[model samples]
Target: MENKQLLEIAEQAKENAYVPYSNFHVGAALITKSGKVYTGCNIECASYGGTNCAERTAIFKAVSEGDKDIEAIAIASDNSSKNEITAPCGICRQVIAEFALDIKIILGYSKGDIKEFKIKDLLPHSFTGNDLI
Candidate 1:
């Protein structure tokens, strides 16, 4: 799927975000190499450390279904002011690198506003399984 389509899916997923604390709603859409799309929304918890980010949620869902090769991923975060394009958090980036180091990452804003980057661009010299080998 195109980046625009993935952004749309992420936007739709944002509506289900359970963020009563920070009120930061985030959504993510991940496309596997096989062309299957999985969407996820941020889920907050009473214990701040227990919160799960949208990107990881989507990635975990895909992984749980036995989809390991992610071709691309789109992330959208909605804010009260200008919805600036936001990249995935540190942990999310690491998790993404674990799956696909060269995956395309699309940071999305309103609708058409987006910025694309390779996973390596976002997380250079990332620690991956190769480090353990």
Candidate 2:
């Protein structure tokens, strides 16, 4: 699917965010190499440490479903700033690296506005399974 379409899915998924604390809504959509799509939204808990980011949620869902070869991921958020593009957290980046080292990362800033990046650009010198050797 096109980046815009993936971003649109993420945008829609943002509505399901359960952010009772920060009230920040985030969403993510990832497309596996098998052409399967997975969507997820940030889910916050009463305990701060229990919160799950939208990117990680989506990645985990795909991985659980046996879709480990992710080709790309799109992330969107209700940041209310045209200049600020939503970015995945460090943990999410590492998780993505674990699955695909160079997947495309699409950041949806607003309707029809997006920035494309590679995993290496977002997280340089990232630690992956190869590092364990």
Question: Which candidate should be chosen as best, given lDDT against the real structure?
Answer: 1
**Which digits, one per residue and each the tens of the lDDT, describe model 1 over residues 1-133?**
7788888888888889999998989999999989999989999999989999999999999999999899999888885116578788999999999987899998866455678999999999999898999
* Candidate 1, residue 121: lDDT: 93
| Model 2 segments more than 4 A misplaced | 80-83
Worst 10 residues of 1 by lDDT: 77-86
Instruction: Assess candidate 1 and give its lDDT.
Output: 0.88
Q: TM-score each candidate.
A: 0.94, 0.94
lDDT of 2 by residue, 54-126 (tens): 9999988998888899999989988624546878899888888887678999996546568899888888999
TM-score, cand. 1: 0.94
Evaluate model 2: give its lDDT.
0.87
Runs off by more than 4 Å, candidate 1: 80-83
